[model samples]
Every structure is written in C-alpha cells, then in structure tokens.
Target: MTPLAIPAHERHGIRVFAAALSPEEMQRDKAGLVAALFGDPDLDPAHVELFDTADLAGVGLAGYLAEGLGVSDAALAPDRARLEAVRGPVLILHSRALHGRAVTLIPDPRLTLLAGYTEERPPVHFEPLPSDAAKGSLTAPGPSAPAPRLPRRALALGAALLLAGLAALVLAWR
Candidate 1:
C-alpha cells in the first residue's frame, strides 16, 4: 500500500509511519505489526496508531485515506496503484511519533516483502523536515460582504422631536 502523507501545514504535527506485514506474519500474529511499532524506541508509544486497511475492503480506499488519514492525492495515487496489483488484507499504520515535530516524506526505493507475501510495501520514511523547506500557506480569506447602513441617529432625532412637539401641544391646550 502507499504511505500516508503529512500535509505541509501539519508537517510539524504528525509523522509518516509505514510498515508492511507478510501474509505469514499476518496469519501468525494479529498483533505482530502492533508489536513492531511499539518495539521501536524512536516512535512515541502515545502517538502510534494502527488501522487495518482490510477494514476498508470494498470501500473507496483512496477516499477513506484522504478523509480519515488526511493523506494527499500524491501519496494515495501510488498506493492505490500498488494495491490494485496485489490481493489480500493490508494494514495501515499511522503514528505521530513526536508531537509538533516536522517529519520529512522520503520515498523508500526498496520494496520489502517477506516469503509468500500477498501484499507489497512501498519505500517510505518519516524524518525531520528540513528548516529551509517552504512552509504551507494558510487558506486565503473569502470576499466579505459590505456592512449594512442603518439611520439610527436620524430615527432617534425624529422620535425626540415628535415627543417634544406633543408635549408643547399638551401644555398649550392646558
């Protein structure tokens, strides 16, 4: 499967976590993948999360990855292509690793696969984003409507004049 993408704006908030399990490993231990994630010292225990891609079976995997994981289309497209070429269950690993720390997305060129594997893993890495990299820009503000005009002062003055004229008429009649 394709690796998850950390947005430019959220680069500091998340880490790119990717792992692949052979069909044998999956069959041997349902928690093997979880163990691998927890076993790593560099990965923060609190930030690590695993999602079974098998859960997304028959559903639009691309859309789910985009919406749920906030994966960019750039990453999702390649992953979708790879998944289409394979069969069987795929598990998705998502880990923040460190809170508010930027991790760079470096594509791993080597595809790691175990014996009798039903799925393939693309090269992926989560490293610190370079300081010189351009940061993502915030969304631009939309056009604002002009404020409505209200004649509050004129209305108040008219009401006061009417009240004074009535009071004068009443005194004259008296």
Candidate 2:
C-alpha cells in the first residue's frame, strides 16, 4: 500500500529515505513533498533520509542521516554508536559552519542548532586607576627601612653628664 503524506506534527518521527536518486527524480520528489507539507520549494536535500519511520526511529535516524549525508563521522562516531546501540531517538543537523556542510549526528534534538550567530562588538576600554593614592596603601608594602642608630657624639655626651652628676653629689657629701 502506498504511504499517505506524513503529517507536519509527525514529521519529527517520520524517516526520510534518500539515496542516489537522479537529480531530476530528486527535484520532482522534493517539489511534490514540499508542496504537500512545507509549501516551500527550498527543502534541504541534506535533511532527507532513506529509512522507513519505524526502522529509522529504531536504529536512531540521526546517525544514519549523518553517515548518509557524507558528514564526518570521525568526531561523532563513538557517541553515535553508543546512542544507536541503545536504540534511542536521534536528531541530525547539517550546516556549513560545522564540519563543513557535513551531517552531524546529534542524539538530542535540543542539542542541535544550540549555537547561534550574533554580531560581535569591539572590546570596551577600561579606566586607569587614579593617581595620588599612597603607594603603600594602594599596593602591598615591601621590606621596611632599618632602625636608626645612635650617634657616637651623643653617647659620649650622655656619659659625661652622668660622670659630672656623680662628682657633684660626692662634693656635696664632703
């Protein structure tokens, strides 16, 4: 029995079967399917798959899509294999930005197209610190200066005063 056109809501679960269909055949099929569902002629051929919904869903269509679309499996093979081995839902995304138009097998649809583009701005200027702040207060203190030494002359004067005071006291006692 011929399969009915897949519903839009069910498109997520529907498995696309794509192969070496001639360019002409691909155009024709693409046109018909696009008219029925998206009503747009810009359907991405890379998004198409070749397995039935059940098999694709069962085998994790994301990995199959990535491999079939000539996407690099080297980076994603291990994780893809693990997901396929577990038989879980898969979502694959193809973009020129990532792996160069290669199909990337993303096991979680949430993970696909997570990164978005935005115009970047130039770096902002930072204000310099104000001057006049105490260097020791503003910055950590370094080694302190050594303690002051007493002058030799001052020491000699102190000794003379002590001797004179003792001599005066002895004379007063006499």
Best candidate according to lDDT: 1
Error of 1 at 22 (Å): 6.9
In candidate 2 the C-alpha lDDT for residue 168 amounts to 100
Residue 20 local lDDT, model 2 = 27
lDDT per residue (tens digit) for residues 131-162 in model 2: 75633355578999999988999999999999
TM-score of each: 0.34, 0.23
C-alpha positional error of residue 81 in candidate 2 after TM-score superposition, expressed in Å: 9.3
Q: What is the C-alpha lDDT of each candidate?
A: 0.47, 0.39
lDDT of 1 at 165: 99
